[model samples]
Target chain A: MNKIPALSPTVLLAVALLIYPLIFSGAFYLDVGVTFLLAAISASAWNIVGGYAGQVSVGHAMFFGLGAYAPLLCYKLYGWTPMAGIPFGIAASVALAILIGIPTFRLTGHYFSMATIAVAELIRIYFGTWDLVGAAIGLQGPATARGWWDLTFRSELPYYYIFLTVLAVLLSFTYLMERHRFGYYLRAIKVGERAARSLGVPVQQTKIRALVLSAMFTSVAGSLYSVKTGFIDPESGFGILVSVQMVIIAALGGAGRLYGPLIGALILIPLQTATNTWFGGGGTGLTFIVYGGIIVLIARYEPGGIYDLWEQISPRRWRRKHAS
Target chain B: MLLLQVIVGGLLLGAIYALFSSGLTLIWGMMNFINFAHGEFVMLGMYVSLLVVMYLGGGPAAFGFGAAFALFVLGVVVYLSLIRYVLRGPMLAQILSTFGLALLLRYTAFWIFSANFVSLPQTSLSGTINVGGILMPIPQLVAGVIAILLTIGLHLMLTCTTIGSQLLAVSEDRGAAMLMGIKPDRMQALAWGLSAGAAGIAGALMAIAYPWSPSVGETFGLTAFVVVALGGFGSVPGALFAGLIVGLIQALSAFWFGPIYKDIVVYALFVALLWLRPQGLMGKA
Candidate 1:
């Protein structure tokens, strides 16, 4: 057990990302980096509930989609500042997170995941038919690349850095969650809720807080997603595939670890980039087949994910033995 | 006049929905796995039955009632291969594996059947049948009758049969059943096979009555999840009642508030039900 460092490898990873765009000047490289960063942030947020707290939510896109829509809706309907709307997105997402988490948290794994998926579909249906957000016609911006109130951007670089900051905050937060008393409560609940409750852990409160933080983090990422694309739609935000992406990312990177989501995103974005560039128009379905297959393989062999591999190789065991 | 028309049409549609929800609930109760790709099973059954229609000259009436049995075989295939292995794994594992299965089945339908929607040709029975002042479509009535028959048959099998008793015992406690000389694995396999077969029967019935695309089953699958959740997980009777309840609620909500907020009503109902009653209506059982 080597001494747990005050500054983790993740802090180093964040620093690396800050400097990455400067060196990786290629268009393809930039695209991959930005995509991974944004998705990684959202996946990390998902980890708070799905990974750390031991809950699986398929309706995560509700928060993500709401995050995308809130800012866009504010811009379209009320002419609010983009930065200001982010807080509103975070607030709405938090409310939804609590609304969903309070009840569905009672469900263990698949049922809970299924509940989330159903909620996402319900949200999608509402958005598709509702007239408030332009209904099925969808909301389009008056202009693009204007950078007014941070509603649009000239390039993807600013958006990348924005998500990178969110990722750093979340990674640091999750690291602390691993060490805090609440973290243990979450793990215990994940292991067995009855036993955890018997041991005096405030199970419901802990789960809800974890989800609240998760919603806040994911919604911010959604806000960035809309700004990057300068468009908002029901399918893009609340799509079932987006929920699947979080599951795959968390599983791939190794759920419950601080850096697992980022590792998962790094692995997936490159594959997605390759598939997108190679297959072009018709490759979409095949790309998903490959995407889903990766998760199946991970579930079968490396259920713990890439983090487990690193844990096995590192001298942390020796350090622990030495300490004992 | 429109009010009368909507109510009649909605009830007829609700009956069609009941057919899909029954199998979904049965699978949930017996196997403790909600087959996310259940809709695709329904989709494949439709295509298979469609082929039956094409081969036997024309129309579902050619096979008449035997079409449900045809779906039974496909269900057994789905069970023996994919589902049997994934049972009793982690919740995430079970869910994702089935979701993968759903994805595979849906995409396969996309490629094999083309993306085009398919339906049986209209006949005299296809039009609305009038009863007193109320008019209901003939096909929906047929679907309603078949769903009730299947539901009753399932109830008897679950309660009275030797295999059904074994299924109930294993679902309650697999380890204890194995200790008592019952083969838990074999029982699980049978349960899965039976559940998949139900999905097939439901699918065949759906295609016989409702027009279908490769993805149409998805709508029902999502709703079936809501129905199962609301009805209480693993309670077929609860699902039957809940399906009708949700069906009427959705229909009435859509009629009054417009379709825009219809799903919100169902979702709100689910959230409230789960909050107020976590074990579900039958969770106490």
Candidate 2:
């Protein structure tokens, strides 16, 4: 196994991303990078509860939609800036997370997942019919002048940097989560909720906190998504596909690991772009076929995901040496 | 009179839901594993019926039977090839494997059938029967009647037959069943076959009344989960009762409030019910 220094790889990656646009000067590549970063951030946020706490929520699109729509709605109704609306978006998403978590967190495993999907779908349907959010037509971000405050950018460069920053912040948060007492509590719950409760861990409280944190981060990503796309529709924002994609990305990379979602996003975003560029015109299902195939193979062969694959291939001596 | 018609319509729809959900509940009971791809099995059944009609010029009975047989074989193949292997893995693996299977089946249908919504050609089962002030569509009435009969038939076969006993024995304890000379693997595979076959029949019945695309499975899948959970995860009769209730609620709500709010009502009630009785309506606590 190669004994590469950890910080060096991260530093090199940062430098590569910093210079990527300047060297390539391609709009498509920049867009892909931005998407990758955004996905990483979303999946990382998902990881706080889903990966660490072992709560497989498939209704995260609810948060994403709230994040995306809250800002756009505030801007349209109250003339507030996108940046100013973000906190409100986060607050709304957290509040929703609590509401949902209080009931759903009582269920375990697949039941919990099913409840999340149902709740998300109910909300999506409600949004679709509500006339205030333009009904099924969906709400659009204000066509404000291009500026940092509005978060509307003429070039993809600024969006890329902003997404990169968000990813960095989320990654740091995940790193802290892994080291903190909260992280231990989450891991304990994941191992066995009954056992954790018997051990005096506040299982429900810990899960609720993790869910709130996860929702807060996911909502931020949603806000950024609307700013970048300039649209907020129930279908795109709260769609089951959106929820499924986040789970797939996090699970594909390695749910519990700090860097798992990043790795997953790195691989999947390119695959998505390439598939769209190639077979997109021919049919819409081919890309999903590939995704489905990858998911099955990964689940059957390596449920621990790409991170586990890395650990397996790495020399035992080195892995054991770095084990924390 | 309109309210009576709505109630009748809801009951009919609920019967179909029960028919499909019975298969899912069966598999869950047999193995304690939820088949996420069960909806795809129904979707495939619809496609199979469509193909039989289009290519072989089969009538409803022929096409329905064809779909059931084809899906039965597919289910057995899936169990032996995928479920058998994944069952040995982690709980997450089992969940995701079926989820993956659902995606694979759905997208494969998308690839072959494209995304356009398709309906079966109007067959001999068209037209409606008016009894008093209520008018019922023939195809839906037939489908609903058959669904109830089949659900009852499945329940009987499970409760009354020797094969049913053996199947139950396997599910109750694989090792003990094996010691008793029952092949748990074969019985489990049979369970899958029956489950998929039921889904196929339900799909064929549904195709008679609805236009659907490849992606329809997602909706049906969610509905099935709700029904299964509400009925009690592994209880067949529970699924039947819950399916009917869900169907009735959907119809009444859609009539009273509009189609959009129907799902919200069903799901809201479902979530609330699960909160109160996590074991489900029929399942033991």
Candidate 3:
């Protein structure tokens, strides 16, 4: 028997992702794929600060909502192509991250998380009432493609490619970050703040930097979401559930690992989509039950998440040398 | 005259906030654990009250006690099952575990109850009381008084009771408490029970006056966190003072700036407060 060459998992995943649209030719599956990539993008972005820096923000949806609003706002108000608003979304998210991070980073543990929630909720409430963003009525993107720049594709295939490319870039960036000194600084901060400061890690600055980068990418993910969905609302874009999903997804895959969120999105999005499809609106309860169950199980059985769980169960020789 | 009415209304609401928040603060003080599902416990309390009224044909007192008893048992069960396991886990695990529990509880409620908003059927606690030209709804007045009494009662229990000391001892130092012959597990379980019972009573009280759905927990939960933080974690008396203040602010803001903006005002103040006094009003430096 000829032994099949041992291609690395990363390469295999990449190959599979690149050809996913071709294999899953149906619109439904392609849409699911796109949704998965979008979720992965946001979760991975969240991982930058939440996973690596160990600051568990429960209000990242504020940035995602801001990003979602930008593109839709541009289309609605200025009649400009939604893509033109991506930079503005990124800018707003970066600025808000700086504004929120400076003060919130002072808090530790649950205090920090609660502060984020308060701030994000405040923002969401403001946006809901603010007429410029269309108030509670929300904003809509292009109904139909005004031009090629409008990105209103009839098929989900284009979005799959677009989102896949974004995910690939984000993952690569995270991979590079893992090897960089900044990544080390983040890990140091995560281990313990006072200790990291004692070791001259510039703890506050490092955290703020991670948050800014994280917010920028999270904003991009939101913008992409609005582009695909062609609408943005306070509830859909800025809800607490949005923030929770990101944290849960990142946690589920083994936070701090490069592929953790990707793995999380891979499992969770399909499951959520399938449940919603099969059971309709009533399935929402089941979805939430599943999410809650997963969170409790992971926290109880393996806080390191599925990745660490696998590492523990896998054969010694098969385990990666530096699994963590 | 209108201002006085608003202030009175605010205080009444604040009393309820304090009642539930004391439970949250108790948990934090005892275990340094934030129960993300504290709101769910309150939600369950409301449901328990509703069921008591619906099936048991109970009055306010009966349902209130029923809710508290149900939630107290639930808190103990939760402590024994999920919380005990994650207590030693990473902060991430600790946070997410309760969060998951919150989701599970919330959605399970949704599945069982459906998503419709429900109110208690006409009970004996109906009508309003005119107090010095300010008409206070009977339910609100009664709920407020009961909530205040219960909160103070809880505070006194902690300071005066043997069980209270044991709970506090475990919280202050688990190893030392164990050396002193106190079973840390039992005390912690009791703390959870007491904490959840308070939340349950608050929920039951609120159910008498306010129409609610399963999702009401999120609002109450966030409000409890704000109250706990404002009052300084682990302080029941602080929760009382802070709850009253928050309730007043919310009422005044809503009256002045429309109801929609009230939450914005509360949260803005909360964030600002966190920045200025991260230790909170009564928290130890």
Best by lDDT: 3
Output the lDDT of residue B192, model 1: 55
Scored against the true structure, residue B273 in model 2 reaches a CA lDDT of 72
Residue-level lDDT tens digits of model 3 in A1-324: 112223267788999999888988988888888889999999999999889888888899998998999999998888999998999999999998887788778766777677777778888889999999989989998998978799999988888888988998998999899989999999988888888899889888898999999999999999999999999989888988899899889999988889999889988998899899999987877988888899899888888888898889998877654433
TM-score, chain A, per candidate?
A: 0.91, 0.94, 0.95
Rank candidates by DockQ, best first. 3, 2, 1
Candidate 1 lDDT, B77-190, residue by residue in tens: 656665665564555556666676676667667657767888866643577767776777777777666765776677688889988888888888878888888887777666
Model 2 TM-score is: 0.95
The single-chain TM-score for chain B of candidate 3 is: 0.98
Off by over 4 Å in 3: A1-7, A320-324
Instruction: Please report the candidate that would top TM-score against the real structure.
Output: 3
> Candidates sorted by lDDT, descending order?
3, 2, 1
- lDDT (Cα atoms) of all candidates against the true structure: 0.74, 0.87, 0.89
Predicted candidate 3 versus true structure: per-residue lDDT over B89-133, tens digit per residue: 777888888888988999899989988999899889999989889
